[model samples]
Target: FKLSLLQIAEVQTQTYLEWKEVHPPQLPKDAVPVFDKKSKQTLYVARLEDCTPCFYDSAKKSCSVSTFHGEFNLGHTVQNRKISFLLNKDNFEIFEWKKSSFGEVPPLPVETCNGYFIARNDFGLGYITDNSLITIGAKKQDTTENEVLTLNHDIKGQHLTITEYQIGSAKASENIAELKHFTASNKNCEAAKQQVKLDQGIDKTVSFLKTRTHTFGGTGETSVSGKVPLIISIGGKLGLKYDYSRLNSKTTSTVEKSLHSVSMEVQVPANHACSIVINSNTFTADVPFTGQLTRVYNNGEARRTLTDGIYSHQEVAEIQALVNPCTPLVDKKRC
Candidate 1:
């Protein structure tokens, strides 16, 4: 006899509730219950059954059924079910078979089931019931030391992967003999040699500045004598010389002088030679050497004097014009 819509729904509901009592819904711990729109209630699938006889395989002891029912006026209808039992075992596990169809199946009463249910239809789309357990052959306890098993589900691809891992007790050691041989075969690369040269330059610069002396020479009847100690500041600037003197043989009198100087900053890198402002008058030729004074101003002088080869006469005039008496040199608008 054909069942009415109301009668069919009632039977489905009754069957669902009965099966739900035996196997409570085993949803994901994070799963929130979804309410059915028609029933205005949250429902879980307890069990699924096929009314028609299923295809059976005696050798495999499995049965499967694929059924299609419904009217075009009512809607599309496709139903598939399969079940397998391990009869030999006392508490035999049951497996549900799913078959795909050309058209969509009518909405079943249960959307989810607590136990394992695997459904595959004619369509590539398939679903695996949550927390399903599948066991083949006899089960045995894992006794191997540090053995681990991992299961991962590919929700998009609808597949499951199982991996096993085990830890080994063997110890690992470096090959000291091979390492020594490899180290002996290696020589200092070009870059390493350059770095060593730079280090030597820096050391030499420090020593040179510490012992540096300045001497003045002129063909005039005056002898410029008396040592001027060269001072190198931490920032690599040449500090001012104080109380410098030029001795004259004719008068036997010494002219005292003090001067302010500006020099360029130099930097050395491991990959390249030292870099310095070569265009500046304070250019120093020695590696790691403090630059020579590009410009010098004698004490009480209004304008500084540029050393030869550093600044042209026009450049010097421009620099002098940029210096304003009313404002600090750094704040001058033209600077």
Candidate 2:
């Protein structure tokens, strides 16, 4: 059966727990997170690293085959993981498995046109078998609904990975997309929600879509790292709003682009702090659509300038909502 991203995530989490006792990650100092509104019962914090993302592993459990953009490579060790097997973008072709020295192959190649190469040695050790000659999308997979197939291979070790050879990739891996993680609310605590604004004025922040992680040491200093994490909390549920009047620049639009209210229940990870960040391209009011559950980081330094982007009526309202903890919470939007 095919697995969705969330399903894959569950498997990853289960795998992590099984291995947690064997190899626990030393949480970084700046990896700690702070709550938007501190409370005795429940606090929301962000995380930096995706403890588990989907990747392919060999049947022998020796090495894995993974795709990075148009290029592919063997996710063997940290050193080779960074290098791409297919660097030239112009050569974006795909490959097929004719025959392997390892054993009888599954009919996946017939169903799905392309996937990683696998090689096995006499010792039963498997490495990413090579097929460097083919370009990424050169050959398309069989489009027939029955073309999709799943196979389980026992090469050597006790490890296993579900490889989707020919099926088209999912949208969750798309650029400029939204990713969300929802956790159960803390027991008996009032639910937390907020409206996030995007900083559209700043091209850099929008371009980079910064990724951040906040690590808090036992000390008071909340050491934030990565791009600046855009973290905030609001009194109500999270939603999107627009001001079309300001679309022309001189004045604000009374009619907003189409405000969307998302009534989502958020549940954070246990014993894990969340993170936040502001990429260089992110501007005043642009809210993040991707990786909602992922944590970002903040510098914690006071803003030198109130930021001109915040002067806009729409942005001002969002800002007030974010910093409401300090004051009685006044509505800043005149419209």
Candidate 3:
């Protein structure tokens, strides 16, 4: 069965309420404590004022409020399935009752008590008028009056307790390697200055659309992996050409490994548009390739817009290039 949004919300609400029943949440208490090893110390004293929540940071070993609300000896004693608070009787049944003969009936009033003591921890037993030392049961369900905990007896005291405490770990340091530059164009400007090897007998025409700043070392390759419409300019007329690499295995295999090296003759257009023509296949459609390029212009006054569209992860693998540092001259107006 399908559940509505409201039904999903109710399921979450019921789960939270069920969890809160036995597992009383840790109240924020910032009570600073003064421990005395030589003498007995009253860890906490609860009253009407102690009803307010407290904030404590155990890692810092510091607290904000002045009173510990019975957390020291009875922190983990509370569970989730035992909430037993009473509803306020005065606010109960605020809705009216309507009768067929008399229209509306008068509300009934009577003295009522609704507050109930909860047994999640030993808070109810420790509320004494006289200032006296009290201890809670360790495992056995015993509620005696004003019991004093002792190390000599096999009570909760002197038992090894596993607690979560905070410890100072680390701080970050400056990186040693330099950062690379990014650009709008598909190619790096400075990288155009480096030489690319063309297979001895192959005649290749390569072009770049945009220039980016990058580091000095890396390998480069190109390949086509999809079906797209190919057009050619013949006799000053644009003509449509069909690329059948998808249907024929021999044609697709040969085109996939064909080498068309990048050259300096081809410049990236001002708006970062780039297109290359290989013998029979036209490369206006998107193809994924990883290569290296260097920073072209680092002049302070030089500014150009990038024109490459970011592709989806399923469309292509991210290209990695070894990038070098390209620091431009500082400008008095802006750097």
| Model 1 misplacement above 4 A | 1-34, 49-102, 105-164, 168-335
How well does each candidate superpose onto the true structure, as a TM-score?
A: 0.13, 0.14, 0.12
Report lDDT (Cα) of residue 320, candidate 3: 21
RMSD of each: 39.3, 27.5, 29.7
Please report how far candidate 3 places residue 121 from its true position, in Å.
Answer: 7.1
- CA lDDT of each candidate? 0.19, 0.20, 0.20
Candidate 1, 1-335: lDDT as tens digits = 01000000000001101121112213322121222232233322222343221223333333323222331111112234333121111111111232223222222211333422323222211123222211111121122111111111111111001121111211112111110000001121232211111110101110101111111111112111222222222111243232222232211123222232223222222223322211111212111211121111122212111111110000000000011112122222221
lDDT of 3 by residue, 160-269 (tens): 11121111221112112211223323233332323222231222221222112211111112122222211122111133322222111111112222333323233342
Superposed Cα deviation of residue 101, candidate 1 (Å): 13
Runs of candidate 2 exceeding 4 Å displacement: 1-84, 87-113, 123-335
lDDT of 2 by residue, 193-261 (tens): 433343232111011111222111111111111222212222111222311111121111122132322
Cα deviation of 68 in candidate 2 (Å)? 29
How should the candidates be ordered by TM-score, best one leading?
Answer: 2, 1, 3
TM-score of 3: 0.12
Worst 10 residues of 3 by lDDT: 7-16
